[model samples]
Target: MSDVRKPWLPPRWFIRLAWSVHRGLYRFSGGRVGLWRPKPGKWGAMRLTTSGRRTGQPRSVILGYLEDGPNLVTMAMNGWGDGEPAWWLNLLAHPDASVQLAGGSHPVRARAAVDTERDRLWQRWREIDKDLDAYAALRSSPTAVVVLEPRAGQG
Candidate 1:
């Protein structure tokens, strides 16, 4: 994919710095706040834990996500430009993962949404933020819309 076509956002140094501060504050607050607080506008944090594909070690990343019905959907943002994100690749290798949202943590299974599903969700996502169109355009491989479904009886 051409670098010029990629949907690279502005340098996220400030956002990362703020996220670090927020993470620390949440830790200090006994994990009560900051989990659902909006950063600016509609963006917020989503903590996802997945097992390492090769090492079987646990890894966690705080990402931005959007809720879609009973599923939690997250764009493979980096993936659009540079193939699938490592964590997402890990999830593909091991579908069992966990997501932390406003209410609580729940075991989830991750998979790339089907074509029809992607078309529908992409429309909804674009409605939320038009910037995603650029992201969708940059995909070297098809951009994956990951669906995180709650484990049976866990919802």
Candidate 2:
């Protein structure tokens, strides 16, 4: 939140570059090597395709997620940058989207987790990553915990 930078935090440019490389690798692999299912007490990667808020076109990204029963939870952390991620903004504009997992693809609707649910999910994340709070503090404000709920007819 402060202008003062933390010594341990990676620079914004490096973070953005790393994200680009990650996405590029996923795209280059044709999705075969990019995603996985979340195992107990751990996180996993998935491909989320959201409609572009402004253009109404598909935009996809690989994001880390934790399965919460029938729902998938991730953070709109923007690589822990100051602003919300574009995909999150897209979800806010158009809640309906699709996620590609190691098993298959399915429709999902996105929303921000709030109150006690958010606290619980955040605690879960802290269990997975001990530095969750430290990294989160690098942000100017609270990051929204995003929930991707399965749409009707899907388990």
Error of 1 at 154 (Å): 8.1
TM-score per candidate = 0.76, 0.90
Candidate 1 Cα lDDT to native: 0.74
Candidate 2 is scored at a TM of 0.90
Candidate 2 residues 1-155, lDDT tens each?
Answer: 36434537677899878878888887888877778888877899999999999999999988999999999999999978788899999999999999999899999999999999999999999899877887888789899999999997542
For candidate 1, report its TM-score: 0.76
57-90, model 1: which lDDT tens digit per residue?
9887777676776888877766345567778889
How high is the lDDT of residue 22 in model 1?
76
How many residue pairs of model 1 clash at the backbone? 0
Clashing pairs in 1: none
Which residue runs of candidate 2 sit more than 4 Å off their true CA positions? 1-7, 153-155
